[model samples]
Target: MQFNPVTFAIPVFVALIVAELLWARRRQPRAYESRDTATSLAIGLGSTVAGGLTAAAVLAMLVWAHSATPLSIGWAWWAWPLCFVLDDLAYYTFHRSAHRVRWFWASHVNHHSSQHYNLSTALRQSWTGFFAASFIFRLPLAFAGFEPGMILACGGFNLIYQFWIHTESIKRMPHWFEAVMNTPSHHRVHHAVNARYLDRNYAGTFIIWDKLFGTFAAEDDADQIRYGIVHQIGSFNPLKVVFHEWLAIARDVWRAPWRHKLSYLWREPGWSHDGSRETSDMIRRRWNAAATDQKD
Candidate 1:
């Protein structure tokens, strides 16, 4: 309930953007990123404003209806802590679903479309991603008696905390810290294009969630990661960026055999028996490989 949409999200969001541009300039003042900054910013800014207003309206109405005559909005206060756990758990489900569901991946892939992994690239968020995974995970909050306010606070906190881990500046952490939380090291692997690094380290806050769920992959300093997706999305148009994947999914689904409908939702991205194996099975065969193997 303490989460004000603007107060919680805007500050960190602004700070991250400012920091990224500063870091990029300091690293090399003349090196302009090939990606379109103006278009990316437009998409990011537009999505944030539209999504925030729509989400706020939905939540406000939901909370009001639940807080009828006898109850007050403050009733949501008691559920704040549970909101954190529920939101994180829901986020895990949300992420996992985004990967498993082909239709959803189209909306979700915008985050991975860039060939370079930088702060500006992080802002290349999808404009229409939530539609793919929002339904299944959000209903639990309502069922658990969490008014809209509490749910919003928990969701906002997870997102705000995750912003800083998107960079390449920070490297490995001290033993215990890396064990429990998501660091740049872990997130780097998540953004990696090398087959071994794809789709791992999906945690938002506590890296332990990935550890417990068996999705964590330690950084490998030896084989430097190549950032971006297999087929880079070439356009800078925000409209194209948002809907491109959805279009791919529709084409794929139309061409897919009827028996494979369910499998389409579970198969790995870019997977088609008709295609190539980008990452060999042996590369990701183990989870806790020695640090020596991880040196990139």
Candidate 2:
């Protein structure tokens, strides 16, 4: 069994979620809804079971890639920090693609399915992430000579860093920290379904990547954040939450012309051959145009 920091952090995760629940009840009674939290936790448990079943095969591929590469970067003191930065970049790339590509979004949409932003929302992971092959983004680090174990450690730590940022509790950090780190405020924008925030802030641990890529969007106080996908799901069933988008994709692809079948799978979410739907970029542009007209 590999040493997974996220596995060890499970107890800590539970403790914080309980503490948050107590705090929410006293401070904001509506912050934690019974059905919503249960749904998030259920989806999270399903993700864990799915991850466990697929971990061995994922690890095998990483090990094979590392062995085939001639570069042998050992675990030196500096190597750890280097791996962390590199892995964070990998995460940003994979996370951005997951939002843009329909095939990947089918697995990722569940995480944003929750309307309430709280600690438990962080655990609402994807049940089909292993099959999505997003982990292929990290293979480059292995081939670059970073040890497989080291890469995994950095990846785990990256995930742990993101867990605390899923809350609505901490409004914002100091300007300096908020400028670099992926704080709760930035993450709120990422989870938002609001037009201006739809496809922005795709960072995992560091906000720098989003800033550099022009994808960062600060949370706006004037326009409050609305979490979840653009088209919300009504069901709290774990199976429904995890696979709804995928089922939708299957139906859409099945009905499309053969020439357009691949487009249905690879195009952005909300894409349509008949121009009836809108992608994130299209949504944001329309919002921006409306704002401009108002200003004019």
Q: Which candidate leads the pack in lDDT?
A: 2
The residue-by-residue lDDT of candidate 1 on 205-239, one tens digit each, is: 77878888888788888879887666777787778
Listed in order, each prediction's TM-score against the native is: 0.79, 0.99
Poorest stretch of ten by lDDT in candidate 1: 279-288
- lDDT tens digits, residue span 1-296, model 2: 68789999999999999999999999988789999999999988999999889888888889999999999999899999999999999999999999999999999999999989999999999889888887799999999999988999899999999999999999989999999999999999999999999999999999999999999999999999998899899888989999998899999999998989999889999999989999998999999999999999
What is residue 120's positional error in candidate 2, in angstroms? 0.4
lDDT of 1: 0.67
